[model samples]
Target chain A: MSAPARSTGVWTAAAGSAAAEPRETASAPPRRRSARRRRRWTGLAFAALPLAVYAVVVLAPLVQSIQYSFFKWDGVSAATWVGFDNYVTFVTDPILRSTFGHVLVLICFFALLPIVLGLFSAALLTRAKQPGMAVYRWIFFLPQVMTTVVIALVFKRIYAPDGPLNQALRAIGLDSLARTWLGDFTWALPALGLIGTWVTFGFCMVLFISGTSAIAPELYEAARMDGAGPFREFFAVTLPGLRGQLAVALTLTMTAALRTFDLVWITTHGGPGTSTLTPAVALYKAAFQNPQVGLAAAIGVVMAVLCLVVALVITRVSERD
Target chain B: MATTVAVVAGLALTMSACAPGGGGGSESSAQPSSISTDIASAGTVTLKMTDFWGSAEGKWIDQAIADFQKKYPNVTIDRTSEDWGQLNSTLNLQLQDDAGPDIASANNGWQSLGTLAKGGLVVNLDSYAKAYGWDSKVPTTIIRQNKFTTDLKTMGSGSWFATPMARTSLIGLYYNADKLKKLGIEPPKTLDELEVDAAKAKTAGEIPFQYGSLDGSTSALLGVQAVLADKNKLNDYVYDVPTVKASDVGMKEAVETVKKWADAGYFPKDFAGIDYQTAVANFVKGQGVFRWEYTGSLGLSTEQQKHFGYVQLPQSGGKTVGVGAAPGAMVISAKSKHPEVAAAFLDYLMSPAAGQTAVDLGLVPALSPDVKVPETSLSLTGESAAAKTLDSDDGYVPYFDWSSPTMLDTLGQNLQLVFAGKMDSGKFTAAVDADRDAFLAGQA
Candidate 1:
C-alpha cells in the first residue's frame, strides 16, 4: 500500500508503518534484521525486571484474591470452596447492600463537589491578577498533604456536639442546628461526606489550576475579543480545555470516595447504625475484625472492578472530546 | 505475552506456597511430652513473645518478664508489644508462620483464641497448667474462661488453650464522689437506686453517665449486668448456645435501660459522636456523675481515683451480677522451638509476684488466694467489685461480644441505633439474635 504524501510528524499513521517495517522485512538484509532483533531483545531485557516485580507484587496477589473470593476462609483455617456465596451476600444482605448507597452519596461530596469547586476556583485563580498566587495554590493543596488519620481525628473533634462547629452555631443563635454530627443517623453519612469534601477539594483545585495554566492563552483572548464576559469565556475556552484534567480528577476522587476507610473507621466506625459504613470499611471488618477473609476478598474484587469501570468510563468519556 | 503469562503463573504458584496450608487440627500425639516447667536445661534459649499491652498497661507483664529473665538468666526473653488493635489484627497471621512469637497474647474469644487453637497455631496448655499448678493459683472460673474444646469450636470447656496474663473485672460503675455529694445522692445499692440517682443527676444538669457509643463502646453492655438476672444464660449465649437467644438473657432489658438513660439525657450530649477516650477524659474533668468502665480505670491517676469510687452494680434481687473478661490469654505457639520455656514464662505471668505488680499498676489479677492486695492500693475498690462478683451466687458473665465473631459489631452498632432512637430494643435484640443465628448456622 502507498503511504500519504503528507504526514503529521512522528505521531502520524506513517510512524506505525515505520515501526511495522522492521518486522515485515524478513529477508531484506541480514545485518539490518539482526540489528532489529537485537534492539527488540534489549528492550525486552530492560522491561523484564519491572514486569517481574509487577507480576509478583500486583498480578499475583490480585489473582490470589480473586481465587480466595470463591472460597470461605477464616485466614487461619482451611478454606472451603463456597463459589459465589460471599459475593451473593453483598447484594442480598441489607447492611452490605446499603454500603453501595453510602458510597454513591460520598461520590457527590468526594468527586462531584470537588470537581465543581475545583473548576470554579481554578477559573477564578487563573483570571485574577492576584499577588502570592503560589501561596494560594499551596493553601489549596494543604489538605492533600496532611495525614488522613490526623485529618479524621481533628475533624472528629470539630464535629463533636460541644466542638467549635457547634459552639459557633450556638453563638450565631442556630442552637437548633447544633446536634451530634457524627452520631445522628440522618446526618452521620453526610457529616463524613463533608469531611471527604474538605480533604479532597484542594487536590482537585490544584489539578485544575495546572490544567487551566496549560491551556493556550490565545484561546481565552479569542473568546474575550468575541464580546464574551468572564463566565462566557470560561464556558467557551476554559471548560473545554479542562476535559482531560476533569477526567483525571473524577477518576481519582471517585475511587478515593469509594474506598474511604480510615476517616469513617476513626470517626463513626459505621455506627449510629450502619449509616456511615463504606464498602472499604466493610471489607476491612470482614477481613480482619470478623475473620471472613473470603468475603473480604470478594468485596475487594468487587471494589477493584467498580473502580476500574469508573476510571475506564471517565477515560472513554474524556476521549470523546 | 507468553513470558508474562508464565511469570504471572509462576508468581501465583509462589504465593500459593506462601499461604498457610490446611490440616491445622490437633492430634493427641502432637502434644509434645517433653514439656517441663524449667527452661534452664534449654541452654541460653531466647523466647520471643508478642502482647497487646503497651507501656501503660504492660507493667504487670513487663514485671513478669523481668522476673522470669532473672529466674532463668539462661533464657533471654524477646518481647514485642503493641496496642490491642494493632496486635490482634496481625496476631493470627504472625502465628501462621514459623517465625511468629513463641507465645502471643491472644484475645479470649472464638474468633481469636478459638481460631488460633483450632488452627493448631497455639498449643493446648492443659499439660502446662497441670505442671504449673495453675488450678490452685488461678480461680476455676478464670481458668475456664481460657479453656476451649479440642475442636476449638466451643469455649469455657475441654482443653486449656491459654491462661490469663492479667484479668479485667466485670465493668464496674465508677462514680465521682464529689459529684454524688453535690447532687445529695447516696451511693446506689441497687439498679433502681442507680436509675433514681441518674435521674437526679440529670435534673441537676449533670451528665449521669459519661458514655460514648462511637467506636462501639461496650459501656451499655457492661452496665446491663445490674439487671441481668442470670449470668450463666448470658455466658451460654456467648459460648454459642444455639437454643438460647439474646432476648432470653435480658438483652432487651439492657437495651431498654440504655434507651431510658439516652431519653433521660443521662449520657453526654451527642454521645454517639463522642469516642470512649473523650468521654473518659470528660469524666476525669468532672463532666459526669458516673462512668461505667473496665480497663479505663487502669489509666486513671491517683488524684482522679480519689473522688472516683467503683462498685459492682447490684440487682434489686439483692444479688450483684457483672461481666468480666481477661485482657488476653497468653498462649504458647505450636510452632515454638522452645515450648517448655514459653510454658514457664506463662506460669510466671500468673504468679503471685505478677499479681502484686498487676494490683500496684491498678489492674485486677486473676483471683488467687496467695495474691495479697496492699490496703493502701487504690485498686482495692475495683478489686472488691471483682471479689463481690466472684463471691455472688449469680457469679460473673463473660463479655457478650465473645459469643460470636460479629456479635461485637452487631451489638455495638445496634446499641448506638437504639440510643439514637433509630431502632427499638426489640429490633436491637433481633439484630443480635440474627447475628448469633447466622454464626450458629455457619458452625453447624
Candidate 2:
C-alpha cells in the first residue's frame, strides 16, 4: 500500500491498482479552493442553527436564572435588586441545607448503590455468558425504559398504608415492623432513595454489561490459567477494563441524583417533614408553589454548579485511574 | 443585566400580545362601568370563565351556566378548567401573560387571590358591589373574609376584589356508618368522646383516622386546630390581627393528641406515607372508620354516601363550635373585553337557580338570606353537621395555615416532624413563628 501511494495520481490510474490512494492535490487548484471554502461556509451555517437554538433554549434560561438570583422577585411583580441576598439566604437557611443533605443521601441510593449492583450483575453475566442473556438484559433495562411518572404512580400504590408491602410484612409475621413507608419521616426519604436505586441500577447494569463484553476473552482465560477466581478476575480484568464505562455511569447517575425533581415531586413533594426535601423539589416549590422565584433561581444556580463540579471530579478521578 | 431586561421585556411583550390587559393591569377595563341587577338585559356578550372546580362543583356550575344562558339568550359562555391547587398559580402566570378567562376563581390567600389583586390582574369590584347592591346581597361576615388591600398583602380591610360563591367549609369527622353502627357507638359530641370512639374503632382492627399529612399536614392539622384553639383567637390569627400570638393558643395538646393517636395505633400503620386520595379512597372503601376532611370533599354518591355520617371535630368538650373555612373568591379579569357581562355572570351565580344547583350538588352556596335551599341528602349529612358548628354563637374560623404566606409550608413540612416525634411543639412553633414574623415584617 505504501509503495502504491508513492506514485502520482495519473500514474496510479494507469497502473490499475484498486488499492492506489488518490491525491486530493491533483484536482484543479482554483476550483477546489473555492468549493472547499463554500463547503466550510455551508457546514458552519448548518451547525449555526443548533448552536443558536442551544444558546436560546438552554444557556438563556441559565443566564436569566443567575440574574434572578441577585434580586427579590415574586414571579409576578417587579423584581427588587438584592445583590447576593438570595444566595446568602439559600446557603444559611437550615431548611435549604437539610435539603442538600437529602440530596446527598439520594446520591447513595441513586448512584452508589446502583453502581455496585450493576457491577455485580455484569460480573455474573460475563463470567458464564448465561443462556437467554438478552432476556436478562431486557428485564434489567425495563425500569430505565419506563416513564418516571408511571413508576411513581406504581410505587405510590406499592407504598400505600394498606399496600402489598405492609401486607407482605404481616404475612411474614413482621407486623410490628410495618409502618407507612413514605409518610414516616425516617423511612420516607430512604424509601424515596430506594426508588432512585431501582430506577438507576438497570442503567448502570447495562453500561457495565457493555463494558464487560468488550473485555478480551484471553484476559479471562489467562486469569483462569493463572488461578484467578471469579471475584479475582473481576477486579484484575473486568473492573479495570471498564474504567471509561464506570466514569460514564457515575457521571450520569450522580448528576441524576443531584438534580432529581420529577420523582420527588410525584412521590412526596419533599414532605414527611422535609425528610425527602431535595434541592430540586425546593427550587420548584420556591419558584412556583411559594412564588419566590428569586430564591428558587438562586437554589437552581447552586444545584447546577454542584452537579457540574461533582461530575467533573468523578470524571477526573476515573480518568486518573 | 441588559440581557435579562431584554428577555423579560420580550416575555412581557409576548404576554400582553396574548391576553388583553386593562392598560397594563393597574386599572380596570375602560369598558362601561354601568352594570345591571337583572341578568336578562346583560347584553349579547360571550363570557370566558376559569376556576379550579372539582368534577362535582363543575357539574353544578355547568347547571348554573345552562340556567344562566337560558336567562340571557344572547350571551355565550366559554370555560377553562384547572386543578384546584394549581389554578391560582397558573392564573397568576396566565394573567401576567395577559391570556386567561374573563373571570376566575381563586382560593383567598396571599398565594392566590392576593397575588391576583396585587398584580393588578383583577377588577376592583367596589363599584359593581354598589351598582348591583351586592353589599346587601352577601352577608358582611362572609363577604369580609375575601377582602384584600389594594396592595393585596393584607386582608380584612380593603376594597373587595372578588365574589365568593361557595365559602362555607368546615373540617368535620367522617365516620363509617356501618362500622359505627356495628360497633354500637354514636358520633362523638366532644373531644374526649372522640378518643373513646377512636379507641373502640381501633380494637376492631380499623384505622380510626384516615389521616395522611404528606403535602402539608393541613388536613390533620385542621382536626387538631379544632381540638385546641378557641374560635375568636383562631379568627384573629387568620385575619392577621397583631394582638394574637400563636404561643397564646399553644398547640402542645394538639401535638400530643397527634403523637398519642399515632403511638396508640389508631391511625393506619403507614399513615404518613399515604397521599390524600389514597386515604380518602381507603376510608370510602371501609378500611377506616373515621376521616378528618373538608366539608366539600365528602362528594359521596347517594349509595356510597349512605355509609357515612358527619360530625364536627369535637371542640372544648361542648357542642362542635368552629371549623376552618375560607370563602372561594371569583374575580373578573380587568383585561376582559366584556367586563360588565362578566360581572353580570358572577351576579347570576348568586341567583336562586344557581344557589339551588349548588345545594342540589351538596355544596353550601353563599347567597341572599331568602334563597331557600332544599334539605337534600347532603344537607342532612354534611351541611347539617357543618351548620351545627357555624350556627353556634361562633361562626367558622379560617384555616390555621392561612395566617401567613409561608405558613402552609411551615405547617406542612414541620407538622410531620411533630407527629413522628422528630420535632416537639416548641421547635415547630418557633419555626412557624419565625416565618409569620418575617412575613409580617415584610408586610410592614
Candidate 3:
C-alpha cells in the first residue's frame, strides 16, 4: 500500500508539472462534471429495461405474495383473513418444516461441494498450459447445458431398482449397494443432492475458471520469487484473487439450492415418505394443486427473504475493503 | 384478458377479509336464468367443453360432438382437453369468471363441486332435472352422485348441480384367462382364495398381481378395497357422514392382509419401482395374471381382450363392492353464455347414439340405462363381464382419496411407505386417519 501511494505521489507530481505547461484546467473541471453527469444518465438509461421488467414481473409478484401470506384462500371461493396462519403452518407442520431441512441438505450439494471442486479445478488449470481445453470445458459443462428434467429422467433410469445401476453392481458383485437409490429412505435425499451436485459443479467450475484467468500471472510469479510452494501460492494468491468469483458462485448456487423444485418433481415427486421433499415443491403444490395460495405465498415470502439475505451477505463480504 | 386477471386479482386482495363466496363487492352475475328444458335448441351458440380425456377415451366425446353438430348445426362445440391436475387447478380458479368453459366434467370432490357450488360457479340443475324428468330417467343412486348441499360440506344430499353422460371408472381385477387356464386357476372366488391364488401363481413363476405405486399407490388401494367388501359404512367414511371414523376394522384387516402379501413376496419384484403405464403394458402382454385397473378400459384389441377376463376383484361375501361409481359428471358453467344450449348438448351426450358409442368402445354408459346400448364393433364379452360385476347386489363405494383434495397426497405418501416396508399396517391406517381427522378439523 505504501509503495503504491509513493508511486501515485510521483505520478501526481509529473501530472502537476505537465498541467503547469499551458493547460485549460479551469474549463476541464466543469467539462469533467458535465461528463460525469452524462455518464450517470447513460447508466440510468441502460438500467431502464431491466428495472421495468423487475418491477412488473418480480417486484409486483413478490409484494403480492407477501400480502397473500396473511390470508386464508383456496384460490377459488373467497379469501379469508388469517393473519400469520400460513407462516405458522410452515413452522408447525412436520412435513412442511422438514421441507426446509431438505433445502439445507441440498446446500451441501448445490453450493459447498461445487465451490470446493470449482476452486480445486481452477487452481489446477492455472498451474498448467493445456491444449484442447474447450473439450474439457464442454465435457464438464454438459450437465449444466442440458435441461434439468431431461437429466433427471436419465438419472431416474440409472437409479431405478432394476436399472443398469443395479445391473452394474451385480456384475461387480456389489449387489447390496444397489437398492433403488432414489426410493430408499436413507439415500433418497442424498441421491437427489448428488444430481444437484452434478448439475451445479460444472457451472461453478466454469465461473471460477474465467475468474482465475482474470487473476494476474504476476502474483504467482511474485509468490514463487518469495520462495512460496505451489500449495502456498494457491492459498496466498489464487484464493485471495478469486474472492469475487467465490462470492458469485456461492450466491447463485445457494439460490439454486433453495429454489430446487423441477428435478424433485420430475424424478421423485417427494415420494418414499417425503424424504426428498423440498420447499419449492411443497410451495407449488400448496399454491397450484391444493390452491392454498396463502400458504404458498408464505413459503414464497420466506424463499424471497432467503435469496435476499444470501445476496446481501455475499455482496457485503466481497465489498469489505 | 390481462385486465380481467388484474381485476379479479385486485378483487381477491380486497375481499380477503370477507366471508367465503359472498357479500364481497361483486355478485356472481353470470348465473344463467331459468335454463331451457327442451331437448332441442336451435340457437347460434358455440359451447366450449372441458374434459380430461385423451384420444382413445375421447373418441366417445368426438362422436357425441359430431352427432350433436349434425342435429343442431347452429350450435358449435369447442373442446379443450387437459390433464386431470391442470384441469382441476385451472377450472377451480377460472370457473368464477365468465371466460371459463360452457361444459366440463368436474372433479367430484370438495375441490371442484364443493367450491364451485358454494361460489355459484356452476349452475344448479335441480329445476332442469325436474323439467327433463331426470329424477325418474336417471337412476336414483347414479343421479344422487351429483347431489351437494349449498355449503358444499355435505355431499349426496342437496340440489343436483351436475349430470353424467357416462360412468367414469371402476377398479377391478382384469385377468389373463389363458395364463389362468394354463395354471388350472379360476379367477379367485374369495379374498382368501385370491391370496392362495397369488401364492400359487408366484410359485409357478408368474407375477400374481400387476401393481405400481409410484404415482400415489392408488392401485394398491384397489387391492385393499377388494378385501373389504363391507360397503355398509364406506359411504359414511367417504361422504364425511359426521361422527364417522375412517379407521374401519375391515380396512385395517385389509391393510394387514396386503402387508402379508408384501411380506410373502406376492408382489412382483421391483413392482415398487415401476409406474402405471408399464404395469398395464406388462398385463396386456400376459406378464401378470391379474391387474387391478379400471374395468371399462381394457384398451386391447379384440384378440387381446379374448385372452383376458374382467372381474370385481374377488368379493369377500360373494358381494362385490367396487371403487368409483358415478364416474365423473358434466356440468354447465354458471358463466356460460348459452346455458340452455350447453344443457341441450349435455342431454345429447346421453343419447342412444352416444350410448351405442359407449358400448362399442367398451365404455360404461352414464346415460340412465333406460336408453338401449348399441351393439359395438368389438366383442362385448369384457363389457358384459364388467357390467355383470357392476350390476351386482351391493352399490359401489366412492374412492377414499376423493373425499378431500389433499387426501390423495396423504394416502400416496403414507401408503407408499407401507409398500416400501418402512411403515406397517397399523401405522399406515393411523397416518391416513390422522390426515382425515386433520382435514375434518380444518373444515370445522
Candidate 4:
C-alpha cells in the first residue's frame, strides 16, 4: 500500500514536474493517471471505516425498527405481519395520547426553560464582575455531570410527603403547600417537568457561555458605539452570533426531553394515574413490562418520525435568521 | 500515517481474534469437571446471573453466588444485578436477543413467563428435575408454576422454566394492635364486624385501613381476597365458570364490595398514590388500623417492625379467604451451551440446605417437609395470629394476578384509575372485561 503522504507527494510532484516538462506530455499523462488512482484508493479506505460503523450502529437498527413496527411480536415469539395494526393502535391508545401531551410539556422543561434561563444567566455573567462567578458556574454545572439515577433518587426523596421540601413549607407555616409532590395527579407531571428543567438548565447554561465567548468583542463594541444598551447589544450581536450553538443545544435538549425514561421510572414509574407517563416511558412499559414488543416498536417508529420532523423544522427555523 | 494505519490494523485483527464468541460461550465452556469434564478441560467457566436487587439485597445475591463458587472452585460466577429501573429494559433486551445471563431471577407470574415460554426462549427442565430429585421435594403448586410444555408453548405444561427461590403467603393484615384494643375490637371475624370496628377506629380518630393503589398490586391483592372470602362467589368466578365474563354476578358483587369500602373511607384518601413501602411505613407509624401486605414484610428491620400487628383480613358474609403465592423462579436460557451444567447448578440451588438459605433471608421454603423455617419467619405474632389462623383454614386462595398471561399490567393500571375515582365501577368493570377478552382472544 502506498503511504498517504508519499502518494500526496507523488501527485503534487508530478503536477509540478509536468508543468516543467512541456515536451513529454504523453509520458506525463500515464504517470499522473497512476498517482490519481493511488489517491482514489486511499480516499476510499479512509471513508470505508466510518461508513461501515454508521451502517452497523445507526442505519441498520433504524431500518429493522421500521420493519418490526408492522409485526405482532412479543420480542421472542414468531412475528406475525399485522400491517399497520400496531401503528393504528398507537394512534388510538388514550394513554399514548396523554403521553404525547406529557412529552410536549417536557419540551418546555428540557428546551424552553433551559434556553431562557441560559440566556439570562449568560447575560448576567457577561457583565458581572462577581468574586465567585467561577464558583457559581461550577455549582450550576454540577447537575449536568451528576448521574440521572442519583438525581432521580434525590428528587424522589425531596418530593416525598415528609421530605425536606414539605418540611421547609411547613416550617414557613405554608401547611397547605405541603403535599406529596409526586402523588397528586395535578402536580406530578409539572413536578417531573420541574426536575427535568433543573437537571438540564446547567447543560444549556454551559453551551450558552461557550457560545457567548465565541462572539467577537469588536462586534459588541461596535453595537455599543451605535448607542446600543447591554440588552440591545446582546440582541444585535451576542444572540445572532450564538445561533448555531443555540440550534445544537435546542436539538439535543429537545431530544432528551422526548426520550426521557430514567427520571420518570425512578421517581414515579408513570404513577398518580399515568399523569407523568411520556412516550418513551409508555413504550418501555408496553415492550418490557407488558411484553408488547410490536406495540413498542410502533411507538418507537412514530416517535422517530415525529422527532425527525420536529428537529428538521427547528433546525430550518434556527438556521433561517 | 501509513505505518500508523498498518500498526492499528494489526492490533485490531489481534483484538478481533480474541474477541470471544458472543458472551456466554466461554463461560458455559468452562464448567467444573465434576459438573462436566469437557467444560473443565476447556477453560474456566464464568456464568452471569442477573437480578433486580441493589445494595443490601444485592449483597445477599453476591454472597449466594460466592457460596456456589466455593463448592466449584474451577467455575467462576459473574453477577450483574441492578435496581428495577435499570434491570427492566436491560433484561428484556438481553432476553430478546438470546444474549441473556445463564441464570435469571424471574417473577413467578404467568404474565412474566407466558411470552418467554411462547417464544421458546427458556429451557424445559423436567428431565433435570427428575435427575436431581427436585420433583418430590418442591411443592406441586410451586413446581407447576415453572413447568412448560415440551414445545415451550405454554407455562406449567412442559418442564420447569424456573426454580422457585422464595415462597411468600399473602396471609397477613398489618394493624395497630394497640389501637384495635383501644377500640374494643378483637380482630373482626366477619365483614360486618370489620366495618363496625373500622367505624369505631375512625371515630377514635384513626385510619381504618391504609392501602395504596399506586403500584396496582394492592388492588389485585384486596380484590382477589374479597372474591375468595365469599365461597359461592369464588366458586362461580374462579372454578365453576368455564369463562370469566365481566357480567358474572360474583365479580359484580366483588367490585361493589371494594367500591363500598372505598366510599366509606375505609381506605386512606390518598391511597391511590401511596407506594407499598409508604403504606407499610404509615401503618407502622400508627396512622391506620390495618394494612394488607405479604407475610414476608414482617421480616422488616426492627425499627420498621415496631408495634405492628398481623391479622387476616376479615371475611365478608361468613367466609374467610386470603391470597398467597410461591416466590419468583429461575429459568435456564434455552440458548445456553452447557444446559446440563446449568441444570445441575439449579438443582444445587434448590436443595434443602440452599432452600433454607432463602428461608433465612425471609422467604418461605418451597420444600416444606425437609427444611425447618424459623419460628419468627413462620409465626403471625402480635396482631398477625388471627390472620394466620384464618389463612391456615384452607380458605386461602392464590392471587389472580397470575391467573392469565397478560392481565397483570392491565389490571394494575385499571385499578389505579378506579382508586383515583377516574373510572366508575361500571366503566372499570367494562374496561377489565375488554382487556381480559382481548388477551384471551389473542391466546386463542
Best by DockQ: 1
lDDT of all the models against the reference? 0.78, 0.72, 0.72, 0.64
1 or 2, greater by lDDT: 1
* Model 1: residues with Cα > 4 Å off, grouped in runs: A1-37, A224-229, B1-20, B23-29, B32-46, B69-76, B130-140, B296-298, B370-372, B376-379, B388-394
> Best by lDDT, which number?
1
Candidate 2 has which clashing residue pairs, if any? A180-B270, A183-B272, A183-B273, B19-B98, B216-B412
State the lDDT of candidate 4 residue by residue for A46-151, as single tens digits: 9999989867766666655666666676665566677678888887878778888898998998889989999889878876567987788888889988999999
Best by TM-score: 1
lDDT of 4 at B56: 40
- lDDT tens readout by residue for model 3, B1-444: 999899768856664645443422233333345656553445577888898887556887888898888887787899888887778777765665567788998877666776677667788777677766777656444565677865666777678888866544667667788888999987776677777888889999988887766555675565566457467576666666646665662566666776677677776777666656767877787788877777555577756656777665546556666665545678878777777788777776756567667766656654434334433322244444444455444355667775666888887788778877788777877777777776666666
Ranking by TM-score: 1, 3, 2, 4
Q: How do these models rank on DockQ, best leading?
A: 1, 2, 3, 4
What is the alpha-carbon lDDT of model 3 when measured against the actual structure?
0.72
For residues B97-162, write the lDDT of model 4, one tens digit per residue: 555687776665545655555555566665566666777665454465566554433444456667
Model 1, A1-321: lDDT tens digits are 000101111123222432435347456776687887898899999999999986776666777787787777778777777778989998789999999999999999999998999899988889977999999888878989998899999999899988999999999999999998988889889989999898889899998999888999999888888899988998888999988778777877887887888899888888878988988889888988887888888888788777767766777787784
DockQ of candidate 1, scored on C-alphas against the true complex (2 decimals): 0.43
Candidate 2 per-residue lDDT, tens place, A50-72, comes to 98986776666766676677667
Clashes of each: 2, 5, 2, 11
Identify the superior model by lDDT, candidate 2 or candidate 3. 2
lDDT by residue for model 1 over B1-444, one digit each (tens)?
Answer: 999899867855654455433665445226767556657777989888898876546766777788888888998888888878888888877887778899898888878887787777888877887887777766555667788877666777788888875456567777888888888888887777888999899888888988888778876665674356476677777777788887889888888877888887888877877888888888888889987887455366766666777777666666666777667788888888888888888777766577667777766765543456655544365555565456334366777788789988888888877776778888888898899888878866
Model 4 spans > 4 angstroms off? A1-54, A127-129, A221-231, B1-106, B121-166, B178-184, B212-224, B227-242, B246-273, B282-287, B301-307, B314-320, B329-362, B365-396, B403-406
